[model samples]
Target chain A: MNPTKPTDDARKGDVVSPTKDKGWFYTDTVKDHFFHPRNFMQDESAYGEAAMGMVGSPACGDAMKIWIKVDPATGRISDMKWKTFGCGSAIASTSMMSVMVTENGGMTLEDARKLRPQNIMERLGGLPARKVHCSVLGDKALRAAINDWYRRAGQHDNIEIEQGRVIDATLKITDKDIEEAVLDGADTLEKVQAKTKVGTGDPSCIPEVENLIRFYKEKYFGAE
Target chain B: MRDIYLDNAATTALEPRVLDAMLPYFTERPANPSSFHSMGLRAKEAVAAARGTVAGILNSREDEVLFTSGGTESDNLAVVGIPRAYVAKGRHVITSAIEHPAVLEPLLHLQKKSEIELTVLPVDRFGMVDPAAVVAALRPETVFVSIMYANNEIGTIQPIAEIGKEILKWRKEHATPLPYFHSDACQASGACPLDVEKLHVDAMSVNGSKIYGPKGVGILYLRRGVALDPLVRGGGQERGIRAGTENVPGIVGLATALSLARQEMEKENARLIALRDRLIAGLLAIPKTRLNGHPTVRLPNNVNISFLDIEGEAAVLYLDAEGIYVSTGSACASTSLDPSHVILATGLSYEGAHGSLRFTLGKHTTADDIERVIAVMPGVVQKLRVMSPVNLDMKYFA
Candidate 1:
């Protein structure tokens, strides 16, 4: 069976109908494309496509990606689309956003920030209370993409400054070099020495070296 | 259409025969079993006879059976009762990672009162707990080892007999000192074989509702001489382990239901196993479909599958629209926003767990029902997948 064809009884429909209020509190709409989702995919290497990748807490049940083609000359979005992998509400919400963005002549980056869950759900006719978060995912994805655009544009200097301490401390040495050294059969001390360029004499790199060694041991050998 | 009823795990439709057996207790003979009159004595005899039926099913002594309100009460009495009785022997207890909250929560509560150390062993992807892990977790202070006979959600049966033998070996090695063992056999009562002596569990919990009986009734078979504290301090009805007014009607129904289920066990298991396999085969044939539990060792009627690009709740709704009902996870914890702990513990992403559905079978489930779901699921999943905003490559699901 194709599993898509509605059975005759289902299509014939006058099955015991619920009271009007009991009718579907919400109706599903194929407002956004699912497989070849409307405006999905990104030209990852496109010269100026504003791209955002969002990873939802697996605890919450979905994640999304949003991409926008912006014409820097006019500050107006040239194309906007989203890809959300989640519940019906989530898919519908993201789809609704894709439709809204394209239908209304893509929002100027600033206008996109004001999008709300209700606006998207209302646009989609209405999502059940339980599915309201689906709409929020779409809104959040758009905002995140915009933020990513601004960040890449170097417009959020304060954020970059505030995050400086973490950046400097973690990236003081490239983590990849440390990982590679361990994988190449280097001993803990040797790997740390090679990556940090600090001899075993330096007490500061001791903890970092120990942690890196421990991380590798646990990851590769199951030895904590 | 009738309201969709997917909460069969919490309880079940009362079998007509079981219901008939209890009508006299409610109306014609409303006599307290404790009463000295003939009517009361008759009720007492019913309880005794029911005990025999329940005991016969488990292959245990009739006196070893203690009827309670249901699985929750039985679990509390077993997990909390036996441990408290032997608190002086040791304070450590062993259980599994995927226990029903009834077992997990009570064990946690017991930890508060005494210096009881708790070790929760983990389960593998198939939801099967390693018996060797249980043996390893047993310590000199280990008072009891509790593992559920079968996982309620994923339907994975544990190597319980092996665990029991290992515990016995430890007891002999330590010279008459070893941890007692308990298993919440609620899910396995009707679906699988449960020979207490062969399994070597000191105690086990069984619920009537899960086996097509009336709710609010169940039993905990405490191997004679196992000490335990009473969770409910009241009329001292259940050998002082559980204190409550006896639910005579419910007990009669539970006993009858158990007998009926036991008689039909083999046939029912084969029937549902065929149906469940068909459902799994159908779902797996669809693109992006993944089976969430073990293939051969799972519950005969449980088929939990995840559609990668579609949300589980939406799939459930679509199925329900066409008169099929199912669940997202454990019915007890469904109201919570988070995905199932068991699924998460199996290392699935929240999206993966959320996009999962559990289709459980019962005596009434038919091939047609499975076909109905199989027919609608792929299309529904496809529709939702297309709408999903996740930029999954089309080929991934197509």
Candidate 2:
């Protein structure tokens, strides 16, 4: 008695490719954003005046650069554009993020700052489990753009860099940071510890580091 | 809207003649070949005839042919089965890095279990495995060497004949009862010459899907005394090498398809090469695009190109939306998000690997299809490149 039964058309084998099912790995919304990305920067000339923020690298196989124009009077994001060289998840995540920031007369700088990857992922009906890291890239770049905006406006005091909840202050490693490390192919606690040096500075975070490794691995790879 | 199916290397539409030949076996003469009856004997004769047709195409003995489910099964039967059968003689195996996963995965699995020491010879920039490397990797303990006749992704044709000859020479000199040569010629059966004797391969794998045949049938030429531990053991079919009830219809379809392919291969190859070259030239006209494989010595039906800054899956999806079927990499490996290892082995950057696309032409592919793709591709590349985050001006990123 499954609630999500295959429709009559699917049962009839009318669907040529099994991957065409919207709910298979990615939702229809994600597919839509990936297929027809909105407010994508057409070229360098299109967003020449917008503040830009870049994250990740081509070598890492995912990179995102976001551009934003803030309304001076309301300090709201007046316009947004993005370019992403990554998989469907990263491209759709950034595309959805640009819409989220600029739609409905745009979000205020503070509201944009408060925006996290989860909000963007939710708007796109969630990404694949392993691709959750791609979602993290959007807000990180948004924050970078907001910082750039502050710097351009000579509002040094207004700029705020959100720091991770430091589990190891000496090594500047946090649980969230450790989770990102795990997402970046550190499938084991030892690998995570080696890459981020999460627990080396302070032995107390070792247990948390191990827990995060297990948590992320299970979350991404599905209990392998 | 007309759909142009360019992903032929993935699979092909079955020919009507092949389908007609298959129909009788399906409904009119459905019998278990192992049964001791007239119907069984008829089925057995049909299978034997099909085997003869396949053997004729490969220039091998009829008894040497063993039927399997498809290319993957045939490859597994050769790669894994050979090592398992002859491990006492040698624990080492050699294969090219650019082999289809059907060949590569089984060898890798055996390596992972420490059952065999696998030497994966790397390909050149054009995706061609060096015959010299295959020769160098040969050892007295090397029980098997498997390489693809042509790469499915980049479409680069390997020197399988030369490599096979070298393997034979090495075996002769060393007096080793080992290092059997196997070529996964699943992609080569339609366009390339595949006489097993001429190639000097101990065994060669062929499948129906690539040659306008049925999907469920494959043939492996075992070169008579070439030993293989059965991957599937059952009713002792295919000379106890592969065991299952005969798929009479599929076997018949495969034979008819291979016969048809061989008949028209010379003319079809020339037609496809012209179309392939035109498509490659037109696609490469787009700024910052590069052809992925060799210029002249590639499969006539294959045109793989990479655009700078954009992800290949996006380009493939865009082409799909335009009613043209293509692939970002091997269809078998498309579900994974990783950049193609074949591209990576060619010394392309990770970004370049991510930015590649494969467009394989088929028998039905025409000059009009190539023209349509050429007209539409530049816009698709421009759209994706505009959306790509990596700035090509950045030397390190590009």
TM-score winner among the candidates?
2
Which candidate wins on DockQ?
2
A31-132 per-residue lDDT for model 1 (tens digits): 233222466554445634465735343234556768866666766677776656665556656766777766656677666665655566566655543344
lDDT by residue for model 2 over B19-59, one digit each (tens)?
A: 99999898999998899999999999999999888888889
> What CAPRI-style quality would you assign to candidate 1?
incorrect
Candidate 2 has a DockQ of 0.36
For candidate 2, what TM-score does chain B get against the true chain B?
A: 0.97
Every candidate's TM-score, chain A alone? 0.54, 0.69
Give all candidate RMSDs, comma-separated. Answer: 12.9, 6.1
Where model 2 places Cα greater than 4 Å from the true spot, the runs are A1-36, A42-50, A125-134, A153-211, A215-224, B330-335, B393-398
Q: Write the per-residue lDDT of candidate 2 for residues A1-224, one digit (tens) a residue.
A: 11122223222211235576442356778789988888888767867767888866654456778899999899999998888877676788888888899999999999998786656766776655445545666787888899999988999998886565667654444566666666656787655653444544356777877877888789877897
**lDDT, candidate 1, at A192:** 43
